[model samples]
Target chain A: MTTKFTPDHEYIRVEGSTGIVGITPYAQEQLGDIVFVELPAVGKALKKGDEAAVVESVKAASEIYAPVTGTIVEVNSLLTNEPGLVNSDPEAAGWMFKIAISDASELDTLLDADGYAELTL
Target chain B: MAEVPTEDLKHTPLYERHVTAGGRIVPFGGYALPVQYPTGIMTEHKWTRDNAGLFDVSHMGPGFLTLNTPSGDAETDHAAIAAIIEPLICGDIAGLKPGQIRYTLLLNESGGALDDLMVARSKTPGTLFIVVNAGTKEGDFARIAAAAGNKATLKRADDNALLALQGPEAVNVMAALVPPAADLGFMQFGEFDWNGTPVTISRSGYTGEDGFEILAPAHMSVALWDELLTDPRVRPIGLGARDSLRLEAGLPLYGHDLDETVSPIEADLGFAVSKRRREAADFPGAQRILAERDGKLSRKRVGLLVEGAPAREGAEILDALGTAIGVVTSGGFAPSLGKAIALGFVSPEHTAIGTKLQVSVRGRSQPAEVVPTPFVPHRYFRKSV
Candidate 1:
């Protein structure tokens, strides 16, 4: 139940064949306030590195990329009402979606906690 | 292929403090200012609305003006200075009692606004303190100097730094530092000493709140800022929250809402032009401004509650039938109102509140309606002593 982070600040925690994906705390901190979260629709297929969501802050807008290829199964509905959760707990409670992994091998491309921290620094 | 140095971006004196507080620094008005801190802009914004927020407005220009004549008498200097500057602005400078402040606009000969500034007649006799925008200060000074024509002396207060302590709880935090600040009503300024350093504190702010703006010597600014942050009610806010706060208040930013091509009458700021000044018709563009006031204006500034998505600056505003009517001067998602709002100058025919309109953003037309300003009501303190 450990999450892997991408150098770009996305986190992927695998649960069986499906993985929950969201941005890391570092990413949310850099983005400032999260005003809007444009999540991918359920059942939409995504490729590794493909844009999965758009997070708009008061200062800027950035695209959230998929860390592993899969089809989106569920999205975080809570973001619509309280986007600040992303800043509050970006990797855990702020997970954007659950995706059925189409290619488990894509997980190798992401970094572990230590590697992600180094990349951010 | 060359990497730019971090110093290439401008930094204010409190840059280190912002970074230490986990603030996200961003380029704004040519300086690297904190946009928000770790708590995030929304929380920071809401916190300011409910509590108190300290803003580093040091980049703003604070300067003084005095009569050019060497009369050596404060009373004579005050009369000469007021008379000389009154004809150039829309406000009744002569009527400005000591310690009184007035918001006025500098106009071009063609009836366009050069800049909107705050002018405060000092209680120390003969001195008028003015605050102008950071981005447009240089041009504003040049224009003011040229208009003064050796009749007044304009001295830029480079040694001073400005800070805004805003929100409902601002008075509580500031009252501890300067006891008399709680008694001053909105738009009123007075001199006080903080730890032996003289300061000018005004009960006015860009945010629609009961707050105070403090101007002190640059060296003393950091000390005062540190002292204020000790209060649990006061947290440092950055430019991000500042923008949303002002937007919710529906205040016009100089370059965006009021510009060289926009006249006061057309910008819905005719109130700033007093009846005496209007009748005198001696200020620059007075004739054209008065004509516009008399219903001769073709376009007028109006507020818009945009539907669909946020329409940003330069977005084209359209009439009900889809014809271009105006352009959005300032538009954003108002954190306080929880909706997208915009300010623009639509044709006079379409300026009525509730008038249906459309705004084109990124090639998409979104429905909008003309609305009144200050998306949020101003909560300035009014002491009934």
Candidate 2:
């Protein structure tokens, strides 16, 4: 399994043909408190940079874009009631959705954990 | 055009204090102010609703309008200064009782709002202290100086710092700091000293909860702030929670909810125009503003109980037929109400409470209803018998 990050601050944990997607801690910190989340429905196909979801804090709402092209296989329905999970555990239990990776070679373009951390700094 | 550096942003007296306390500083109204602390906006907001929250509002305009030449008599000097201000704003300043604070709107010639401000009579001869929005203060000050600067000296107390101690436990915290402030009821201001620091406090605040706004010399703010936080009931709040608090209180924020094109009547701030001024209609834009007071307004500001996503500014307000009727000025999740509530302007026909409407949130229509403001009931402190 390999965890990759995009410059826009989204992360994807890749395992074979599937990948789990979520935002990085740095992004969550900038968002302050998360009050609402709207995710794309399953079977929706997204292109890289497409606005895939929306996360709202008390101050304002922001869009989360797709890092790689794929179809959404599953979503974190739990976020509908408890959006604070994004602030609590953004990378683990707070993962937004699972993407069925259409292009495995696209993972090579992403930054590793250390690379992303350095990029943020 | 060259980009402005963050270093160019002004810092308040509480900047270092906020940094030491782990506050997340953001650019706001030409100042680098804290948006939240390490505990985050949610915790800080909830804490304020339950306890006292101390806020640094030094970036706002805090100044006094005094009679350029006092008659040495309190009544005569006050009347003289009030007469000068009466022409610029829609308030009956001349009729204001000493030591009283009145929330009023500065008007344009078209009866539109220039800014909303709080004017407090200092109870002393020739003094009326006022506070205006941070972003508009420069323009507001210029206009005030031009309109009545000669007749009534406009003293921008830029050297002073302002703070707001808010929430249910605010009075308790304030009383511990200054005993005299405890006797103050709602909207009453008094000058006092704290550890020899000249301070003016009023039982008035932007939050719907009971609280007070204190102003003192800039050099004295840090000492006073540090001392206030020594009490467990008082925690430092940020501008993030402050916005939510005022929004929940249904108080319109200038530049967003109010502007040059919006009138006091259309913004639902009719009460800010004093009852005496309403009949006389002597202030600026009286012909149009007073004419609209009879309920013939084209649009009216109202509250909304949003069912789904939070509707932000510029969101479209639509009728049942998917026709746009109005636009949202301010909208957010009300922490106290535990739901998304918004303030917006709609046509007069849709102004009635319980009138069903749909707010287009990011192009998705969300069910909403016209509700009475404030989203959270105001708990202002009133004197006990």
Give me the TM-scores of chain B across the candidates. 0.94, 0.97
The CA-based lDDT of model 2 is what? Answer: 0.89
Q: What's the TM for chain B in candidate 1?
A: 0.94
Candidate 1 pairs with clashing backbones: none
Alpha-carbon shift of residue B217 in model 2 (angstroms): 0.9
lDDT of 1 by residue, A34-107 (tens): 77777889999999889898787775557888988999999999998777788888877888999999988888
True contacts kept of 2: 0.62
DockQ of each: 0.29, 0.57
Model 2 spans > 4 angstroms off: B1-5
Which sections of candidate 1 miss by over 4 Å?
A1-21, A40-52, A65-75, A97-116, B1-6, B9-11, B70-76, B319-324, B360-367, B383-385
lDDT of 1 by residue, B246-349 (tens): 98888999889888889999999999998888877888898888899999998898999998457778999999999998999888778887778889988899
Per-residue lDDT of A75-115 in model 2, one digit per residue for the tens?
99999999999999999989999999988888888899999
Taking every candidate in turn, the Cα RMSD to the unseen true structure, in Å, is 3.6, 1.9
Clashing pairs in 2: none
Q: In CAPRI terms, where does candidate 2 land?
A: medium
Query: What clash count does candidate 1 reach?
Result: 0
